[model samples]
Target: MRLILLGPPGCGKGTQAKLLSRRLDLEHIGTGDLLRAAIRNTTPVGARARPFVDTGNLVPDDLVNELVAERFQRTDRPSRFVMDGYPRTLAQAHAFEQVLAQWKLPVESVILMNVSDAEITRRVTGRWSCPTPNCKATYHVENNPPRVAGVCDECGGRLIQRADDNVDTVRARLKVYHNDTSGLIPYYRQRGLLSEVEGSGSIEQIYASILGILQPQGG
Candidate 1:
């Protein structure tokens, strides 16, 4: 099933998407990751993508649509895909529908991993990442604190909160999410394709909730 994974920042959307992608045998297409990859590669796309990435704003819809369209057409493409971090606004949603209609692959469901704004702030503030450049190894202050304070378990590098992960930046990103992305809730609801999975539980529990929604007939 083609899917859209929806949630605020720190809502466990990406974690749940990764699990569901594996279980359902679908590729996980995270637009944020795509932009980051582009930036890292410094390709023509990256060069053009950098300005938008530096400031936490959604990329232009046309470019995003093209990237997603190209991914969907790959030869070894998954049976379906779980999309993360794309269609941050209603216009992108419209664009996505047009492209999917052209491909004749309308989304089967939109999974919403619901978490509150307060929870989001709490979750992000406590999070830390590996100090290795470009390696974002996330840890938590309360839930998953490192073996040693301010050090990554995997790389032995110091752990630090990402510049974007700080309170001010997280708040800015949250404002953007609330303003632009939340509209898709009603949009998908109108299509009768939205399923909400409570986003307050262990990763496995959350994954199970998502699976139940996706394959409601229980496979």
Candidate 2:
């Protein structure tokens, strides 16, 4: 059940990873979450990564690889896992392969959630999040607006759009994604481990599609 879920920003990779991990009883290993935890815990790797993360720049490949390598080497690492956000570049992908080889943990599949740029822009730019530290409820300006304008329904906290979710930032992120991460599609496809899933449908529908691909025939 080991898998790598790949997609551009706002393509629902996080949501799908959570769903798949819960349904199959596998650990969901999201790189963003991992980095945040490390930073919060002040791990050595996190110390090295903080400068770049604070500056809104991509963490160097070496630092990211080190972080991932450390995670994979954890004594409590899950036997089965879903990787959500590592390997954002071809170099990272190669580094990840090396890590997996060293760890003797071969990936079973790489799921790419395909979505158009326009749709992604719409989804990401409309997103807003609660400002309260403990209550981070999310809403969209259109699809799932908060009960009251600019306010979180659950805690009455002000809703703020993340700077990274702005149109300009999202476009920049998408550019990087297409230029770098997209190459992994062909890389994995050539190895016969790539599976494409439509990312625009209902969450349940998309989850079902992923399950269909991962499940054994007629199982």
The sequence of per-residue lDDT tens digits that candidate 2 reaches over residues 84-202 is 88777778889988888887888889999999999999999999999898999999998999989999999999899887888899899899889987677899999999999999998
> Best candidate per lDDT, number?
2
Off by over 4 Å in 1: 33-58, 72-79, 132-138, 151-158
Model 1 lDDT per residue over 1-219, tens place: 789998887788888788878888888888777667667877566677688878977677777776665555556545488888777688889988787786678888888888888888888899888868767788999899999999888888888777777788888988988888667789999889888888988888988888887777889
Model 2 pairs whose backbones collide? none
Best by TM-score: 2
Residue 151, model 1: lDDT of 85
Q: What Cα-based lDDT does every candidate model obtain?
A: 0.80, 0.88
**Minimal lDDT window, size 10, model 2:** 70-79
